[model samples]
Structures are given as C-alpha cells and as structure tokens.
Target chain A: MSSRLLSRAPQDTPGTWKSYLGLGVILLVSAFPVYWMFVIATSSDEAVMSSPPALIPGDQLMVNLREVFTMQDVFFTASLINSLIVSLAVTASTLFFCSLAGFAFAKLRFKGHNVLMFIVILTLTVPNQLGVVALFIVMGELGWNGTLLAVIAPGLVTAFGVFYMRQFIGHAIPDELVEAARIDGALTMRIYWTVVVPAIRPALAVLGLLTFVATWNDFQWPLITLNGTDYPTSMVALSDLASGNYVVYRRVLAGAFVATVPLVVLLLVGGRQLVRGIMEGALK
Target chain B: MALTDVRHARTEEPRHAPPKRQRFWLHRFDTKTFPYLMIAPFFLLFAVFGLFPLIFNAVVSLRHWHLIDKEKNGWVGLDNFTKLASDTDFWDALVNTFGIFVLSTVPQLLLALMIANLLNRKLRGATFWRIGILLPYVTPVAASSLVFAVFFSRDNGLANWFLSLVGFGQEQPLDWRAGTWSSWIAIAVMVNWKWIGYNALLYLSAMQAIPKDVYEAAAVDGAGPWRQLWQITVPMIQPVVLFTVILSTIGGLQLFTEPMLFDENPAQANGGYDHQWRTIAQLIYRVGWSDLNLGYAAAMSWALFLIILVVAGINALVTRRLGGGK
Candidate 1:
C-alpha cells in the first residue's frame, strides 16, 4: 500500500505545457460565467444592455442587493433562511439515521440483511421524481402540501445516504472493533454511539457536505411545492426572479450571486473531500 | 464529551450488572430486534413516500383526476395513456428532451475525457485547477441557468457579441430561445457547462487509480503518448466511461431546471413560444400543475420513467459492446 502510494508521486506523471494550456482554457471557460454573474450583479441595469455587456465589477452591488431584498414580489431573504433550515435538518437527520442503519447493516448481523440491502441499492437507480405527481398528491392528502415538511420529510433519510454510510462503515470500522465493543458488553445503540460514529467521521463529513450542497441547489420539487409562496427556497426564489415579462438582470444576478456565495465557500474549503466523496460514490 | 462519558460509564458496567432475566431480555432485544428498529425508518419512509407514491402513480394515471376538484376524480382506465399516445406536444417534448440530451451529453463527456487526461498529470496548483473547473457545478442551477440565459440573450448578450467578434451573426443577433435548434443548443450549453468539470473530476480519480507501472511498461514498449492514451488509458478506463454514460443518460433524459429556467415565462412552464425546447419533465409539470390535469401528468410521469429505463439500458448495452469490441 505504501509503495502504491509512493508511485502516485508527481515525478512519475510528467506533464507538458500543452496540457497546462489546455487546462487553463478549460478553467477560464468554467469561471467566466460566474465572473459575468458578479459583473452584472455589481453593475447598473444599463450594463446588462450595454454593447459588449459589462465584464468588470461595478459599484452597484449594494444597490442591486437592496433592490432584490426589498422587492415586494419575491421573498429573497426568507428563501435563503428557508433553504438553510431545510438543508440543515435534512443533513442532520440523514447522518444520524443512515449511520445507525449503516451500522446495523455492517456490523450487527440480523435476519433479512442482504435482502434489505439489495432493496436499498435497487432504489438508488429509480429516480424519486418518477413519482412526483403522486407524491404531490400524497402531500396534499396528508395536509402537508404547502409546508416545508413536504420537502424535509421525504429527504430525512435517502437510500443513497444509507448505502453510502453502509459502504463506509463496512470498510472503515472493522469487524474486530465491533466485536471488541460487543465483548465489552456495549449495547447495540451504545456501540453505535461510541465505536461507529467516530470511525466514520470522514464519511459523515463528505456526506454532509454533498447533501447540503445538493439540497441547497435543488430546484424542481421545491419549485412545484413552494413557487409563488412566501416560503420559497433560494433556488425557487431565484427562478421567480429569472422569470416574468420584464426581468431586472441586475437584481436577478445580484440575488443569484448572494445565494451562491455559501456553496462557493463550501467548495473552496472542503473541495478535496467533496470531490473524493463524489468519485467514490460513483465508482463504488 | 459524550463519547468520554459513555466510555467512563462502560468501564464500571460489571460492578452493577443487571439481573440475569433482565440481561437476557436486553440481550435478546439488542441482538434480534434492534437491527430491525434501526432499519425501520427507511422502509417506513420508503413505503409512505417512495414505494407507495410510485405504485399509486399507476392508479392515478388510470383515473380522471384534477388538481383542485377532488370530488370529480373517477376511474378512466388508460384513457390518459391513449390520449398521450396521439399528443404531438408530448412527442415534441420527448424529441426535444432527447435532442438536448444528445447535444449536451456527447460533447460534455468528450470534453470531460480530454480534460481528465490533462488533469491526470503532475501540475502546479492542482487543487486550484480541480476546484476551478468545478465552479459551475457548485453554482445553483437556477442561478447558472439565469446567467446563461442572459449571456445568450439576443441583442446585447455576450454570445452575440462574441459571434460578432468572430465575424458572424453581426447583422441580426440570434434569439436563442426563439428557434428549436437554437434553444436546444443554448440549454445544452448550460447543461454541458455545469457537468463537464464534474465528469472530468470523476474520470481523473479513475485515471489516478491505474497503476503507474502500466503506463511505464507501455512507454518502454515504444508507445507514444497518443498511442498510450488510446491503448492503455482509454481501454483501462472503459468501465468508468460506461458508468458515466449511463449516469448521463439518466440525467440527460430527465432534463429540467436549465430549460425550465431558460423559458421566457418560467411561471407558464412553456419551453418557448413555439414549444421549441419543451422537455418531457417540463411537459409533465405543465400538464400536472399549470393545466391541473393530474391523471394525464401521472401517465406522462410513468412514460418518462419507462423512457429513462429504456434509454439507460440501451446506453449500457451499446457501451459494453463498444468497449469489448475494441
């Protein structure tokens, strides 16, 4: 394993300037739209219509943000707060429930474990959106049609999260550690709380970050459930701003730019882990 | 603090052990029933919110249901499905969905493969490069789609300006959302912009897992860089390539958000004035919510689910053949 790790040293993969140049161009294309967003967010309304359009940041960011916040049609600030509450609630519950279930699947052998696990893996391929029509109806029947509960409840524990946690726990927390805990008379819940949680902290972090970003960026369900209401999430609110007969590009981009800052910061801080988690989730 | 408290309490567990009968019961509960309890939430939620809805969609599609008039909902027995069969709008949306899927996914994967190869080498500021490419992926779809909508706007948009700079489309700037092919290309650009880097990173990780010795041996056998890439890198990453193809197939077929926001009137959920780029998802949304016909929407939803499954299966089959034949 150590030799394998050593083989990944930079000396082995000698890169050329052509590759660097290609990457540079790709990065520029990746970043320009975001930069353009910033430029329009900070510029005047005229900048959106100017010849060649604004490519540099202007001083009207405060002005555009103020316009967006105080606009009577959309609840921009409330949407941000709503997104935070939903994302955090979903992340917390997903972690606790999935980890507990993952531990049960991994270490604590029980009846029907393989069958139940197969079901979980199978559900991963079936998009939940396939049933959105009935789901919306179900929400209405349960009197949760317009509430945040409709969004938060179904997402509290995802099949993907359960499968991911199970994979991580099975690999990271060895059977011997679990055996040792059981031998010490640790109860199942006790063992999960003590031995399992700490061992899967990295997995928890990865899952947490991915879930938060995904929830924050989620659009379709939230749009259907919360559009035109005062309780819209940030993404729905941004869509609201984008639509309409006459969209103020400055205000629209300003709201979008503000909503995206937190996710960008998350990407900057936990990017390596986030990338690893995504790749691992796909490959495994 | 909680962990340490648990540990401290654990060390003194034998001093005040429970009675044998109580311990036996506790042990039984812990070993036999606890795992079921741990896993019960997932099954319960899935039954209520996942499986039930999926199965119920068939029932809903078979009936005549409206969004607001609950009293008038009645059994119609596949009428909605038959209506959908002759619906040109639905067919157009299906065609648009597949059109945008092909246009976006083909280029996105190809560029992602090239970018991954570039990134799989030693480079300065590697973290910057990785994170930089992922900028669009992290941006909210609503936000990025709106930004792209403006960038592709007809008169004063950057896309037109660039076209002029390249000595084309100077007289009449292209109205991106007005034409069928133009709107698909515009939405495809939005889809490709967000996903290319993400797919690149996935490919890069897979590339890193290929042992260095394989490349060294290939190099020693007089395989140039291009030959090594085709014979060694491409063949080795075939599974990952197939995996991404299926992934994109599912995602591309269910195209939403980008085109939904790209619409001139998003509240109406119309893809364009001519229904140019209406996707199956948007069509479902329009029929269900805007038109308030839940039964037809449910039918469309099931059809979409089947379509995705079929397309994904075909992609998997074709990819396996291509990989193995080579």
Candidate 2:
C-alpha cells in the first residue's frame, strides 16, 4: 500500500518523451489556423497575395480592424452587440429555466417526472434540421422573421441543458440536505434560491459558457431568419464579409479573428469547467 | 441529544410563527403546483418551436406551397415526395453528405482516439496542452470556414505551398474548391479540425476515470503500450466511443455552415459551380429559401431527419458489435 501510494505521484507516472513530442505536434496543428488568422489579420493586402502567403504578422492589425468596422455593406459593430445581447439573453434564460426544471425533476417527486424526463431524452435525438422549413413559416406567421426574436426564441430552453442540470443536481446535492431544508420549513422556491442555486453554481457556469458560445457562433438559423436584416449576428456579418465578390483575405480574416477572440478568451478562462461539463454528460 | 433538541427548537421557532393552517396550505401548494410551474417553460417553448414545427412540416410537405407559383398553397398529396424520388440534385447532395461524413468522421475519430491516448499519460503543463487542442473547437464555423477557404485557395495558399515544398503536386497546386474530391477534402479538414480536439478531451476524461492499477498490471505483464491501448483503454471507453459516434453521425449528416460558407457566395447556397459538396441542410436552405418551394423543402427536411435516424441507429449498432466482438 505504501509503495502504491508513493508510485501515484506525477513523477512516477509512465509518460515517455515520445508522448510529449506527439502532444507538441498536436498542439502545433491545433493552434496553426488561429495563429495564421492573426498573422493574416495583421498583414498588408500585398502580403496576403504573396506567393507563399504571409507567414509572419505585420503592423496592420489596427488598420484591418478599422476597415472591418467601417466597411460599407456589413454592420460589424452592430452585429457584435447583437451577438452579445442574443447570447447573454439565451444563456441567462437557459440557465434559469433548465435549472428550475432540473431541480424539480431531480429533488421534487412529481407524478409525471419520469415520463417528462423520457420525453426530454427522446427530444435530444431530433436534429435541428428536421423542422427548419416549418419553423421558418411559423416565425414568419408571428412576424418575427428578420428579427433577433426569431433567432432567440427557439433557443430559450434546450432539452440538453435540462437533462444536464437534472443529472448534476441529482448527483451533486444530497437528498438528506434537501429533506433537512424541508423539515426546517423552507419553501420550495426559497430552498431552490438559497440551497440549490449555490450548490450547482459550477454546473451553471459551465452551461452558461457553453450556451453563450453556441448561440454566438450560431450561423445557419440566423442566416435563414436574419440574412437581409441590417442588424445581424456577428457570424452573419462575418459571412457577409466572406461571401463578397471582391475577396480580400486580410479583411475577411481580421473580421473572423475579431469574432473568434471573445470565445477563445472565454474558453481560456473557463476551459476546465467546460471539460468537466462535457465529460460528466457523456460518462454516465 | 439535548443540544440537538435545543438547536431544532430554535430553528423551528420561525415555522411555528406562521399559523399551522397557513403552513399546511403553503406546503400543499408548493408540492402540487411548483413542480409544474418549474417545468412549464420548457414544455411550452418546445411545443411552440419544436413539436409544432415537426407536425407542421408533415402537413406542409403534402401540399404545393411555393411562394412564387400561381398555384400557391394547393394540396398536392404525395406528389412532392414522388418528385423528390427522381430529384438528381437531392441524390447528389446525399452522396456528398455521406462522402464528407465518412471522410471527416473516420479520420477525426481515429486521430482523436490517438490524441486522447497521448493525453492520458501524465505530462507537464496538462491544462495548457488540453486548451491548446480545444482552441479550434470554439472558433465559429463561419470564421473557420472563411479562414480555411484562404488556406486551401488554389493561388497563394499555404496548403499548396506546403504541398509544393514536400514535392507532391509540384507543378499544379490543387484547386481545392473546384474539384469534387478536393472540395470534400477541404471541407472535411474544416469539420475535423473543429471536432477532433473536443472529442479527444471527452475520450481523455473517460480514460482518466479508469483505475490506474489496470495499466500498471498490464505493464507488469508483457503488454506494450500499443497493445494495452487496443486491449484495455479502447474497450473500457466503449460506451463513450459509441456516444461520440452517434453524435458525430447526427452532426455530420446535418453538416452546414462549413460547406455553405465554403462557397464564394454563401447566399447562393450552391456548394460549388457543379454542386460538389452541398449537404442536405444546404440543399434544404436552397430549396426552401432560395427557390421558395416550402413544400418541397419540408419534404426534404423530413427525409433528412429519417436518414439521420437510420444512420445513427446503424452507427450505434455497429459500435456495439465491434466492442462486443473485441
């Protein structure tokens, strides 16, 4: 037992130098495109068209960023703000609604909990592409097409979020504690506010971060609903820059880099939680 | 026991202050209705956006609901499906979808498995390595596709320059967007680049949960690391592998954004001049929005959903059998 304990240290593990080399290569391959994007973003227009392409960054990043903002056709700043609003709104509501439902499903013994949870699990398999046509029509009927409402409404609550929270709440919080709160005469809403919310904060942050990124990066639906609108999401605006007739690689990449930086930074901050969230969902 | 009694009495004072009758009513309401209210929003929103659209699609698919045609919104039962049966464009899209699915998913899963195996080993700066690989996954699809488009462009592309440096296809750099196989490869790179690290991390975490003594025992025996990975880690993480397989199948079949933006004119919804890599989702978007044939698009949507269900089922079945056989 003593030997086993001693052997469990990081220095005693069996990783070879070969593994480090392989991971180094993986890291390089993984990071190259984003690095290339920055390189292009900072390069002159002539450098973009150079025979080998620009392998190094220049001093033109500010110029290109300025160009992306002042470009005539795309509303870059407005779309960035639009993306922020839609992402935050969706993330907030998804966290609240999913957690509320998840708490009830986990702790509160209701008549139809099992059946409702089964429905939620089943809904996970239905691809979003299945109902795009009909959804477009429905949005049009509600006069929400070409508006952020059309983009935001369908994503207010997700089946996966509810399931994720339910699983987390079931496992993370003890039934005895909940029963103790009940015995102390704490009402359900009050208990959830004070007890459940605080305990499940890590899960909430993970879900919120993921939802924000997914909503921010959403391209297809927004393209379908808000393509021609003056106020588009950042993704839609990037697409506008990309698909233009006069293809300027520098401008397009600068816009893409700008759109991607916030997400990359968010991931850098909350990557461990994100990893925990994904693995927890898949393992059990 | 006296200490517990005193603490309980002190805590119970607040509840006793609310008269017994009111407390009883409050508890009943909390138990009965609060659960329903908590779960109501999900059901309500899903009905409006999710289930209703599905049923609505079934209804719309049977009618002639072209926005431009003079015979607008006519009930033409089964005609749209029959016409779709002979639609060459839909078949081409289907082939391209499966082609890219195979091309991307197979390599992505294998590479992810290998990377996860590498990451499973104890290493220095572990979080840095993890976040490094996962960086691509967070980049927006629109942005990544645009970046890759430049990378794989025929003229002045780093891909071609690298290929030239390696002395393969030295004379003629591949026009990645022009050729069918070339376009599929380019788009597959975009898809695989985004997903490989994410899937790797999932596999890595599952690997971490496995008992370390298992590997130690294998090493004590005659097993090499390669044999141990195949015989142990792969089998141990079979369920996670299955989960990822099903997920990739669904996401792969419904591939959009990458192929859509791969086209120079994304709004055109033409995957290419000859429709080289147009997925079913792109085709649906084109038919419904571009052509204004809501009925036909609805029919295609239903067909694509069924295809996804079938493909995912097959993938799950095959994954299970592979694990069992091994």
Every model's TM-score: 0.95, 0.95
The residue pairs in collision within model 1 are none
Task: Write the residue-wise lDDT of candidate 2 on A1-284 in tens digits.
Answer: 53443234222366689889999898898889999999999999899989879999989999999999998879999999999999999999999999999999999998989999999989887776689899999999999999889999999999999999999999989999899999878899998999999999999998998898899999988998988789799999998998766778899999999999999899889987777776677676
Residue lDDT tens for model 1, B116-168:
88888788888888888888888998899999988989989999899999998
The 0-to-1 C-alpha lDDT of every candidate, in the order given, reads 0.88, 0.89
Query: Interface Cα RMSD per model, in Å?
Result: 3.4, 3.0
Which stretches in model 2 have alpha-carbon errors above 4 Å?
A1-12, B1-8, B11-19, B216-221
Model 2 C-alpha lDDT per residue in residues B1-326, reported as the tens digit of each score:
67556443463367346788987898999999889999999999999999999999999999998877845688999999999999999999999999999999999999999998888866888888887887888888888889898899888899999999989777887889999999999999999999999999889878888787776666545565667678778888898999999999999999999999889888789999999899999999999989999999999999988889899999999998987745
Model 1 TM: 0.95
For each candidate, the DockQ is: 0.55, 0.59
